[model samples]
Target: MPKGSGKVLAQNKKAGFDYFIEETIEAGLVLNGTEIKSIRQGKVQLKDSFILIRNGEAWISNMHINTYEQGNIFNHDPLRVRKLLLHKKQINQLRVDVKRDGYTIVPLKMYIKDGYAKLLIGLGKGKKNYDKRADLKKKEANREMARAVKAKNQF
Candidate 1:
């Protein structure tokens, strides 16, 4: 109903911090009417959300799209395993990579795309402890450099 106003309901910032993302794919969600309404109300959580290829199909688990407060007995489960719309070839490739390479599928973000709720899923590998520390240090250094440049330019 809104023009050029695609709303991003939620995001999984921890996914990027913990995983080395390899590839990302946009997949549509299978949601009910009430679920979509709740998402539009911005009541969703992406923490601990993950993807898995099961029985030749992809499903998202641990995502909590809160039920509409006004909805009654027909309300969907908050943590239901929602189906992800992906191609058969993509599913096969994800299955192979996850099973053999010790990789994982993590939800990067959830956004309203073209008036439909979509998920940006990433193929990721767990980062080591040192890797996390190094990344933190790099970010701090970049921030310090930017601050110094700003201070110098202010004069």
Candidate 2:
């Protein structure tokens, strides 16, 4: 019902750590026959994948969808560049953002929603090393606090 809320198949955990996600948009994938089958089987990987805007169209490169076992001869390429179905206005907006604002388009997650494959893409800016270190420190502090709370509850 909400953005990124679906039967998640794969996620790029590194994206969040490496980039500051400013906005997210759900886009449909133009998959081949066996590609959808493989995705529905949860045999997909979003890691190392990124969204590229070329010729006023959006494409996702390096997204891996494993070949379907049953689709021997009809199997699709595992790492093909798949087209993303976005509206013309959305594509223009993303292109402008990437070209002008120095933002990178990263694929956040892949999921199946209502029998269709969807990709959650975000407009992100790369984080510096200091920012990453700060985030790690904050995460560690949160973990320690949670542990203390749990230990206190056990008493």
User: In candidate 2, what are the lDDT values of residues 5-67, reduced to their tens digit?
Assistant: 889999999999999999999999998999998898899988899889989899999998999
lDDT of 1 at 97: 84
Q: Which stretches of candidate 1 lie over 4 Å from their true place?
A: 1-6
Q: Estimate each model's TM-score.
A: 0.91, 0.97
Local accuracy by lDDT, each model: 0.88, 0.93
Q: Report the number of backbone clashes for model 2.
A: 0
Model 1 over residues 38-121: C-alpha lDDT tens digits?
999999999988887878999999999999999998999999999999899888988988985659999988889788998888
Which candidate wins on TM-score?
2
